[model samples]
Target: MRRSTLFLVAFFSLFILLNSDTRPDSTDTSKSVTQEKVLSHSDKTTTETEHHGAAPSPYMVIPFLLLLLLIAIAPLFFQHFWEHNYHRIAIFLGLIVTTYYATVLNDFVSLKHTLVEYLSFIALLSSLFVASGGILIKVDKKATPIVNTLFLLFGAVISNVIGTTGASMLLIRPFMRMNKDRIKSYHIIFFIFVVSNAGGALTPIGDPPLFLGFLKGVPFFWVVEQVWLIWIIAIALILAIFFMLDMNNKAGAKEDQQYSGKIEFKGLKNLGYLAIIIVSVFLDPAVMSWVPSLDPLPVGIREIIMFGVVFAAYKTADKNVLKANEFDFGPIKEVAYLFVGIFFTMIPALRVIADLAKENSDVFTSSLFYWATGALSSFLDNAPTYLNFMSAAMGKFGFDLNGGAAQTQLFLQNPDAIQYLTAISVGAVFFGAMTYIGNGPNFMVKSIAESAGVRVPTFIEYIIKYSLPILLPVYAVIWFFFFRG
Candidate 1:
């Protein structure tokens, strides 16, 4: 309790410091103007300049790197300490970066933007986590290789409808239950690869990055039109691999239990709450002009609605269903706390990447776009990475990212522009499967599986054992077949 109080006090202190002196000083006006010129030349808005400040010193990225390193290693080496104080550690590291931006850089706008983004992120994730937890699914069938493969395939498809986060939160518990007798780390890993990331590539509703693209003037159906083939090829390849792996495992249900081949479901009303959450995703002013803006405040009506769902869903949830699902707050809490640090410290890293991408826009090819966007999206937030690369791609064709839907349509009409955009979209969505932190759903899935006593891999093990060996080859094939030009 004392620790929780300290955490709140420190958080508000950081907030107060950032909000105190947001106006630029007279002495800094000239520098701000010069920085604005560079930013504008890069096709960024003045608002973006306010959000990112000048080109951050590359050295400023150290805190982000360090936080990621600690997140990866601390749990492996210092399990107890990390499990207990991760929130404090995350806040402490976030404070370092926030203090730098607030005092040394005097760029409170960036801090505020990060805060808003963090809130929206948490609001969406927490709502889905809570709402889905109230529902219970029981699959009374023997876990077979074909059955598991089909289940994952269905999950991938529905991900486009309810979103990767929604699908993951809804299906993971049932999936674990079905495979309880033979569940392995590979089961969860493949789930992450297919449902949580690659499955979401076909629609804006499927993933945050694609949704941002839709807001930026890309047609709502454009992703499906462009990437459907790539999505099919990738998902098929992944599912095949999962099938082959599953075939080798001979584990079956215990001798005392028999399969009834029946599926049981409860808490159907939460589906209405999920539909409301999905509808609320479009409540942003950027998407619906009729939606009022809450400028200066990071969140708007959408976030408020989603957060309200979190409270309402939990309060009205059936106790029997909740107990059946073993629902708790542990997974969401971990994602919320760790991601705050990630969002704060990653400001400079994103800025540096944005600057580099813009400066070299003229020379970049579609292949480069795929790899660069994919590499960064593996660690940083894929949504912003998608936007940054799209901005650079648009600049390469003499267009502005903020030039409204007409300008974006004009850019998309160019054959070359389509190629670049496709690569960026695919990279951002597909490569998000490369790490647990790549997308919002990955970590939550991992946390849920662990809480259920699944033997999940460590962060490094996930990368070295599964990602490099499996996903890397598949992504290379995708690039070769589609974006090699």
Candidate 2:
């Protein structure tokens, strides 16, 4: 791990030294003009010149790419070491890029923004993780194909209400336990596809990417309003496919041998905690809007509320509930450590994309945004990728990145902007199913399945076997019907 970190530092440093603009005078004026043109649209008049000089060169993207490669390859090639040292690696990479930005580029504002974003993002994810861990749903039914499909469908519906992570945590155990005697790998894959990814397309609470969008001024319901049809179609098709596959598999085997029992939900009080988080999500922005004098940040208040609720749930919930669920902090800790690096190193890549969008806004049509965002989100973590494309899309339209409810309203009212936003929303959420690393819950589900003695596919096998043949075609249909049209 140390050798890898040193190699990464040396390589990124050399690359940045050789490629990044060392002098401020070398900054592209055309990019500056484009940036100014976009920021000019803000409701608040800016006396300060927008720092188009901070446009990152393509060289700065190396750290981001290297980080992504580390995430993708390290686990496959160096599983034991990667498992033990991922957090350290993440921190090292983050510091390397941040140091470059601070010393070489003299851009601390970007670093500050990135860090703040990381904190808020991790805080919310942590709160959700803690709170969700307290709830356990026990299943008492036969593992029939139809019943399994119905459970997945139910998971898909509640995914929007409780979030993909929350819903996955609550349901995966029961789903696994119900079919433990007769479960197959395909069942797990389908669960990750429909329950962990596609189901999260309809609401801000459903996915981290959408929640990031919400915090960045997108309306809470805008996701549903824009992509409900796509969500419904995708879920319907996947469920239908699963039903057929299960039926065919079941027909060849003898069933009704596994014992069944009645279903029961434990830690019912956690539901209230979950509701508090959701309500806080919707209401915090409004509260911020009402009381402009709030200190620190309104989001901080929301974070505090969520953390408090999480603590309450953790204390009030029974210990046996967590034991039955086999709950642990490993998944959330992994996400926390990994995403911090993603948020930080991705700063320059996001800036470059935004600058490029400004210079050539016409090139980034709705279709382009959808594919670009989704394709990247397929391998990279979806939350930061979503924010990156969102910034570029906003810059293309000369919209304010920080504009909240009013900007969302304007975006909804404009037909062209609506197309881009909808594309972005659907792409980030739906394509997250393409890979385990695409979303937090994907891997969590995989780990739990493995612990339960189910053989989950490797990264390459999963993509080649399931994602490409199944998800890509569905995405193509969405692109043609929605984005292109």
The number of the candidate with the highest lDDT is 1
Tens digits of lDDT, candidate 2, 1-485: 45755654553454344334333233323334533333211111111112344566678778778878887778789989988988777777777787787788787445544544555555566666667778777677777788889999999989999888778877888888877767888899999999999998888889878876775667777888888898888888888888888887753224545444678887888878877877766544332444222222213456677768767777777899878766776776677667767766777776665565556666789998899889888866676667666666776666755454466567567788889888888888889999887887888788788877899888778899999988899889889889984
TM-score of 2: 0.82
**Candidate 1: which stretches are off by over 4 Å?**
5-52, 254-257
Off by over 4 Å in 2: 1-53, 215-218, 251-261, 283-287, 290-299, 381-384, 387-404
Instruction: Please give each candidate's TM-score.
Output: 0.93, 0.82
Query: What is the Å distance of residue 105 in model 1 from its true position?
Result: 1.3
lDDT of each: 0.86, 0.72
Count clashes in each candidate, considering only residues at least 3 apart in sequence or on different chains: 0, 1
lDDT of 1: 0.86
| Candidate 2, RMSD to the unseen true structure | 6.5
Query: Which residue pairs collide, candidate 2?
Result: 140-261
Model 1 residue 455 CA deviation (Å) reads 0.6
